[model samples]
Target chain A: MAFATKRLGKELTKLHGSLPPGIELVSAEGFEEWLLDIKVLDANPLYLNQTYRLKFKFSPSYPIEPPEVTFVNTKDRPIPMHPHIYSNGIICLDLLGSQGWTPIQNVESICMSLQSMLTGNTKNERPEGDQLFVANNRRRPRDIDFYYHDNTV
Target chain B: MVNAEQPPDPVRALEFKEKGNKCFQAGDYQGAEGFYTQAISHDPTNPLLYTNRAMALLKLSHYESVISDSLTALSLHPNNMKAHFQLAQAQIALHHEKDALESAKKAYELCMEEVMHGGKGATSLGPIMELVRRCRKEVWEGRERERTRTEKGLLGELVRDLEDRRDVEVQRLEGESAGEIQIEEVRQEYEGKIESLRGVFHRAGEVPRRRVPDWCIDDITFAVMDDPVVTKTGQSYDRSSIMEHLKRSPTDPLTREPLHVSDLRPNLALREACEEFLEENGWAVDW
Candidate 1:
């Protein structure tokens, strides 16, 4: 836990210096959780002129483990419609999954991946089982065993 | 020593220790120091009280007092990590670089021992390791300073020796047939030699621009590698970081292939390069 926090501290200092375009840090008040705001730079009709808020939760064994990332709904923010994104803000990306995650991935890299995932999407509908999963699912994003079969956006 | 007239009051000491902790958390180091002093008076045998006082004194930059209090705490409990850490901090502040490095290494060793035993102080290893690195850097800089001084003194002696030889040659040439020209040539030769030696020393004394090379940094820990090991994929990482990773997951962090701790080979060449870089730029430990 201390090692994770120290590494996060270094990452935070680097983030303060500069972040990639289309990705902005919302808040990083502690090592436990951070919020980031990302936007699709190109004029994708589905995600045009919209901002998405991402929440990242770090476990004690972070870097070795992937962060729990999910979208959050607010008054001004809405969950973007995508085939892999549910109405409840849960995302189905292999990069977020334990098997697909590697220590080399970082917060900024995650944000960029999400940004590109949004940019490449043409479908404006949620996952087929979105409504049911949103209603019945009680587990966190990291714990859910998502089968990553879909490669096309 | 306890006032033998009145028995030690452990309960009062606990109360005062709580007060000291509260004050220390609130950033009132003076108040914290006072409370810890009272706590120590109540329980003279408790090393925790002295450590608390030392921590407060450290915050207040009362380095000498911090050293004394930390020493007292260590005397009470020789393996107290906090006491050793504080003593190292105070020693570093006082520019006792060698002593600070020794104390910091002691703390780091104790932390590692605790980790090996599955004890309670595993969380403290990160900070203790960082302190050890800082102390090592300080000690290195101290030695560099001493080496520079010795080099300067040696350069002075060499220059004087050349000048003395030139004077003797000129004195001998004064009685020769072509005395003036030979004397001038002897002086010019010695002066050129002295100038070249000074140039060499000047270049040696110049401080190298501080930059940690990418090859020396471990991608896993994002730190300058002290002990680097090569993975099967040709990537290198700090040995401790890779071992820790292998403990949790038996896959290469980069290539995601099935990997084992036994698969790692010491990157002897890269390790030597990192060590050589650190010898000149010890501050890269923080990098």
Candidate 2:
């Protein structure tokens, strides 16, 4: 607990990195036992112009691994009830793949990937059994094993 | 309906006590409370009934009820050190500082005496001594801090804290902004140098009306332009007006296939056309 950790927030938000428009980093600082923040980004265009606060939980092992990310302050995005996404803000992406994780990735890259994923995919389909799946689950989303499907999506 | 098979008082009391302890271990404080309360009622004379019930209440964070139970225990048996220790904790919660100090003193006194006996000394008192010191220190610091805390009026001090907090936030934001500008500068520096097309998506738009650059027209040979098939390669080619690429990398004669226009091995006319396109667009054609 005594080990001090610092966020290079300023470094994370450069211009060429002018993140897919409308996403803003509101406030970020230490919380609970780890550091956290509320990031407001433009919602999926289907739910246009809305801002959603996503919670980021970075483990001691980050960069080498992706930070545990999720949606916190909910609005029109509907918490993205997909097979890979839980009501809590965990995302399963090939980039964050268990065996395929790349050490060079960062929050900026992850956010960009999320932006592209949201923009390119044009459906409102939830994971296989959305309602029952949500009801039965009690653990955080990162713990679930997802069967990612369809390259066309 | 009360099951007739249910055990009587002694057995039921033991059962509930064990059940309560089990639930407490499992982090089910609410279940523990219900069970301990039932067991205490079944055997009211046991000081331990009050003691365990108080601990259960304490675990539930029902501090006031813990004080009540501890006091009730002390009334039944005046020398109950556990009751005194728990009573001190509950008093602290209720802001009964003076009473907490007295009870903490009594508990510590009993423990200190036992420790002095140099035999049968309670090991639990090691931490309890720290607790007593912390409680007294808390009371002392409260008074010291309270006096200093309100050197100004409560509202004025709160307003000042709000303003100070705002100032700290403003400073942090300013720091972030300055950092962002630095990052932008660095990214710009990096962007200016690197022309490689990695993550860049081709921006789609209507074809611009600007005429194709004369450089493409001058450098490319006319024969490669008209025919889609044959090229400088002598290798048979394909497509219309590949004169654009032909000038850049003609082709291999025997193969007749257009030479790799840079890295891409497009056929004759197609290769010519690509060369013209890159020259006109001012892009690293190979890229």
Candidate 3:
């Protein structure tokens, strides 16, 4: 109840208000995890009018540390095709990574950043080694050794 | 301390001056100095501006800066009692006895004239009069030592004047600040009455006692625990709840890190905090 549930409770209360466009909170039933839906507003042909779901797994460190954020592919949600996104829905964005995350960036900002990332992208393919990494990778998204040489995304 | 980034606007400068006043009232002398500097830059000719900044500098114990600001204020408006009083105070603080005596005498004379004219300068008159008496005593003592070495006559008239001034100053200061003491006493009495009313309401069960924040409680049991333990990742849980989780899985319930029963350290600080909270709020045990 210290950092995990207490912080998530406040975040959940904030998410109930009107959010920025294209980022909608789907479910936040518990303090551990939350599901959010984000859409690229502009007519980017790769993700034109397509909605994507993001799954956020928050550790107890929470805002002091970054929440674990990745795309969740379900029956209704599909992972957007980007060079940074893997086929298994793991995104390799630096903001979700350890080195680039800041405590001030909240759930809504993360969703908007993801939405903007998709909107500005022109690529229709996943990361270069999507299939190989998706098949063998068992590490958590935070633990993954992501090479963030690509800043254009 | 003036922020050079914003373009100069007198209206904005006034706003900043008001902000400086608020900061001064809140005892943020450094912040008030910064704001006052900004205000002075926008309205440089205002004598009161320098006087206001001098007050903040005085509280910060910047004796030299206060003296400089008070000099500037006095140069612009020679009749300013505040700047004179502040100059006297700063000089005295810096142990410039002769200069302090001169400034205090001038301030006391001006303050007395203002008070005689039915002006609102009585608030400052009392303190300036006290400073005058102190400075005169210091100067007299310094001269008396020199006179003792030179075998000069003792100034009996000056000593009589000091005693007369002491009695008159004491009577006047008591009369003025007496109203303030009475108001303070009445305010304290009303505050006590209000506190008793609140206690009566509590006994009648009209108002509930305060509750602890959810963060301080155990998530599983939903109670304040005496023995709390923190995980390596910094999430604290009740010892019993975490022990039950550890028996099923050797990982933390939240972080899923490779935690063992041996890794769970007793949170001594949180345990003491919980005990203190319970001591004040015994009702929270049931809550």
Q: Per-residue lDDT for A18 in model 3?
A: 69
Residues A8-57 of candidate 1 have per-residue lDDT tens digits of: 87678778979999899899998999999999999999999999999999
Find the 10 residues in a row with the least total lDDT in model 1 chain B: B114-123
Instruction: Kindly list the per-residue Cα lDDT of model 1 for residues B1-287, writing each as its tens digit.
Output: 78877689989999999999999999999999999988888899999999999999999999999999999988989999889989999999999988998898788768766755667775576667777778878878888889989999999999999999988888777856555777788899999999999999999888877666788877776778766889889999986678677777788988889988678888999988987887778767774
Q: Which ten residues in a row have the lowest lDDT in candidate 3 chain B?
A: B150-159
Taking the candidates one at a time, how many backbone clashes does each contain? Answer: 0, 22, 0
Candidate 1: stretches off by over 4 Å: A1-99, A105-147, A150-153, B175-179, B202-217, B226-283
The top-ranked prediction according to TM-score is 1
Model-by-model DockQ, in order: 0.40, 0.03, 0.02
* Clashing residue pairs for model 3: none
Task: Kindly indicate the candidate among 2 and 3 with the higher TM-score.
Answer: 3
lDDT of the structure predicted as candidate 3: 0.75
Candidate 1: DockQ?
Answer: 0.40
Lowest lDDT 10-mer window, candidate 2 chain B?
Answer: B218-227
Alpha-carbon deviation at A23 in model 1, angstroms: 20
Residue A150 lDDT in candidate 3? 82
